[model samples]
Target: MAGPMISHSPAAPPRPGPGRRVVLGRRVVLGAALGWGAAGLAGCGAGREPVQRLRLATGPEGGPYNAFGRALAAATQGHAPAVVPLATAASVDNLHRLDDGSVELALAMADTAEDAVRGRNSFGRPLPVAALARIYVNYTHLLAPADGPVRTVADLAGRRVAVGADGSGVQVVARRLLETASLTGGAGRVAEVPLALGESVAALCAGRVDALFWSGGVPTPAVAELARELPLRVLALDGPAGVLRARYGPVYTAAEFPAGVYGLREPVGTVGVGNYLLARTDVPADAVCAVLRTVFDAWRDLLREVTAGARLEPRFAVSTGAVPLHPGATAYYRSVYG
Candidate 1:
């Protein structure tokens, strides 16, 4: 029988008039070749052509996804397959790439991944993607000028808040959080401002925005910079810290932003969601399994090399909710944990 076919559609063009053209330039072809290489081990049957590369969709430069991708590439290189990292917009974009076959592997937020698989949130239809591993949890940090009046998540009502670029995971979760806190749809409570991560800090400093919500790893450069130069406070969500986990499923958990993690005077309680590695349903099982093995075997070393705070223990790598685990990755987890 022939293997499953994966489709690569053009990404929705940058916002403006009609969506931007989905450019299938040389990079797309290169990405496809890399993806094949990463999954090559599964095609080793007699008379099959050898696979050459694997393409991974990472996030914007300097973000946790990008760093993790680079580390993953380094760990997988020459062991199972040659891996290439394609920097993308972030979680939502990464999931779209995985669904459209633009890349074989991607990094996604558990919440966003849940929405895509269930067609519940931003994704209008169910997406055909599966999880390889749950890597780490992203703490939603609501950063405001330390002296600002916005002391809680609800205080941002009616104020200009940078929710990250449109279609980005930041925007998706920010809206959900606002609604959860009852800050949306009311007069003078919530104003969503779509801005890139790079521009969000400047916008806040210039007083164009009152607060900025970012979900990322510890010591993010943007967050650290803002904390150092400005009077910044990381706000605490209103409900109990574990409320999201209880209502939304185990994908979220209560996490602490330690006091002095970024020069804060005290620890701040918040909700967090995991980040997972994802792939299209059509990816070969053997290839996926090989990649999973490589990542797991090198988890500690990769964590040390990428970000000091990142923890890749096997205990934190299993998907808990709407996100479906890939068969190959499931095998890997069973082999290691069982």
Candidate 2:
């Protein structure tokens, strides 16, 4: 049974432009001397302050957050503090871990981070966490088979859908999108299954699920792999994107999956959210400064490993919206701009 053709809005917000290329050149030298250089960061080096082992909460095994986190951990070895990446549900889980003192650093979507700091949605009260940087943009991917009956958001009614794991950012966006489309809760509820990215991909391929919601970078490895095995379509989501923005502030933006992504013949409009690197408010300023310096210094290396065209520019990193910058991060940025 072929699904109805999915058509995207012509006015879909233009795909987010590429990361502005900044020529590091001499700045790299100055930055290293004052910020992340081996000699400059003596506090993190041997024979100075004992190297602090900071637990960084990353996403599930096959996700971008996990990949980026691990790469960062590797980049900081023998230089900055020993960063240890812990695999967990992405975004929401990472923030919760940061709040509970289980993690010193976390990566989270801007929406979930805002909820935590504002005491809305999943969080009971304002959490004491701060942003280290806004690392990249995440595109909300609502995927279904090209041959399946599910075509539009409205078609998800009564369908078995993988809405991400219990403590993940994907679930947060999935529920809201379903509700806005009137396909969730009440009598028309979707059969929501909480599965991690890998499990969700397996479920969809095996016919255990009609569709799945994933919020990550363009060309998510799992989604691309699924496309090769079975024909698929990323549903157009311009309508839901508007509704979400009207309800929330500037957190949600209309974005599109470019043609050739996941084998799509055309672009698909969806939602976009910023991915932020966060830290527990209590983490030492010098430690956070060192980590930020290391990230900025080693960004190109990190970019090569991370997918979805992730960027790590200082200007982009500083645009964390409502999330307050950690004091250490603040110092690092000051050094960069000065």
Query: Cα lDDT of all candidates, in order?
Result: 0.70, 0.78
lDDT over C-alpha atoms for residue 117 of model 1 = 94
TM-score of each: 0.80, 0.84
Query: TM-score of the candidate numbered 2?
Result: 0.84
Error of 2 at 136 (Å): 0.8
What tens digits encode model 1's per-residue C-alpha lDDT throughout 1-338?
00100000113233223533323222322333345454432232323333456789987777777877888888877765566899888888888887777888888888888989998767889999988777766777788898888887868878999998765778776777787777778685688888877789899999999999888766677788777889898887535445566667766666677788667888777766677888887776667767877786777665553334565544446533567666556545444443
Winning candidate number (lDDT) = 2
Query: In model 2, what is the error at residue 237, expressed in angstroms?
Result: 0.9
Model 2 weakest lDDT span, ten residues long: 1-10
lDDT of 1: 0.70
Q: Which sections of candidate 1 miss by over 4 Å?
A: 1-50, 238-243, 304-307
